[model samples]
Target: MDNRTNLDDYLAGLGISDAEESAPLPPAPDTTAAPLPDAANESPKAVLERFLRGLIARIDPELSVTVRETEEALEAEISGENAARLAGRDGRTLGAIEVIAYTVLAKQEGRGDLRVRVDVGGFRRRQADTLTKLAERLAIGVAKSGEPHELQPMPAAERRVIHIALKEHPDVMSESVGEGAARRLIIRPRHS
Candidate 1:
């Protein structure tokens, strides 16, 4: 299928792998770089960007798309007035978009996994900051009170932020409990 066809056709850039793990993205788009020999001589990043541009145009003309090839994965940052709306509450909507993007794009014949990541209105960054601080505060409280604190159920990405935030914490540790959508992070005082 032609990627540039429409939003529904190209919203598969953010699908997760079998292990439900995040793939590495790219750095930045090089304007003068030679194009890959794809359907239109465009690289994966180029194709994804073109597809996102068309998607954004349909959603909100004021919004803009910037696709960067990080050393990790293809990062698409959407920004503008209506960006927060697309971001959804706590980035749930953006997560949905990312999942669809990855699943769809990865299944495109020889595409394999495109390693695409999306952030709407910088929601990922801001949410990471908030989650990190919350984790730290809860960890401290758990350590002092000798009690465990179970936070609200969160998605894998959000739970990852909390785990990583307290990875080296001296007094507390983090763990995820429950299953599927009910999975949540728990902070507890270190046993030792």
Candidate 2:
């Protein structure tokens, strides 16, 4: 026995009657459109603020981020009880978040040179102050002892703070040594 169903029979079986099948499709949507807004024209700080706020909202719905822009950099200050979690241990998580935020903002603005700094509960400021004091004390020790002192491994940014703190010391000098994660700053007596 042969079993063949015509097109109309198939449609009827599926409840799509001939009238509906014969109806013309809605007119094709208009394809022409104006160009997208120039992302470069938007402020980098604004882009960073939007990105950071969205990220923080995922972690703490009640938290808020405040962004400050300067000629040298953009700073995002996270405020809330849960904000400390973003800082992570030793501020590594905060550093990673800053890297990701700056990267995203740079790509969106078509400029990879944008600098963004992230801080949680004033952690970065306090850390910088601590590093500055340590550098001063170590420089004095090295100068008095006429010997070198090697500091514990630190991130590039922290090391930079130490170097800057001792940049003008008359009796001591600072240099970075070691490779990759093991890199650290060294303070030694000035030869002259």
Candidate 3:
């Protein structure tokens, strides 16, 4: 008739009790647990968009950026009176921003090689296309004259575009030479 129970006796009684009553309540079955996120469907483009959103949120709370994915990479287009500030001198700022954005997205997606391109007012795309055409023209000239044509020194990315554009050329050969700031592409006639 006495319902009073000591703490040690209560614990011992539970231990001695059958599993149906004392087995620590079986953990409640976890019905309200959150579903795992669908990272499998996530792409480099989505990560890039999220990264740019974060950057804009921190740097320019009032400014908005639009992101698009081309066939090869992610591109972000931003506009504002301070857009030039983001673009920097000859787009150096934009390029630096791009490196940071790519790093962020790569880390988020567990990727080491994510490609991201940040541009202001379509400058980079225009520059790349124009440089590609120039390379093609120079390659044609070198092919016709059978003499090596030296081009102005360019950054690694531009040089890479030139090389890739001329990769299929049957009449000319493209080679990058020199050191540091002096490096340039030399287009010459292919061997007969």
lDDT of all predictions, in order shown?
A: 0.71, 0.74, 0.67
Task: State the lDDT of candidate 3 residue by residue for 138-176, as single tens digits.
Answer: 987888888899999988878988888888989987899
Question: How many clashes in each structure?
Answer: 22, 0, 0
Q: Which stretches of candidate 2 lie over 4 Å from their true place?
A: 1-40
- Give lDDT tens digits, candidate 2, residues 85-132: 779998989988888787666656777877888999888989999999
**Backbone clashes (count) for model 3:** 0
lDDT of 1 by residue, 1-192 (tens): 555444333332321222212222222333332322333345667656655664566677778788899887889999998897997776778887787656555544256656878998888898899989998889889988998999888888889899999999999999999999899988888884
Per-model TM values vs. the true structure: 0.73, 0.75, 0.62
Candidate 3 lDDT: 0.67
User: Which 10-residue window in model 1 sums to the lowest lDDT?
Assistant: 14-23
User: How does candidate 2 score on lDDT?
Assistant: 0.74
lDDT of model 3, residue 67: 84
Considering lDDT, where higher is better, how would the candidates rank from best to worst? 2, 1, 3
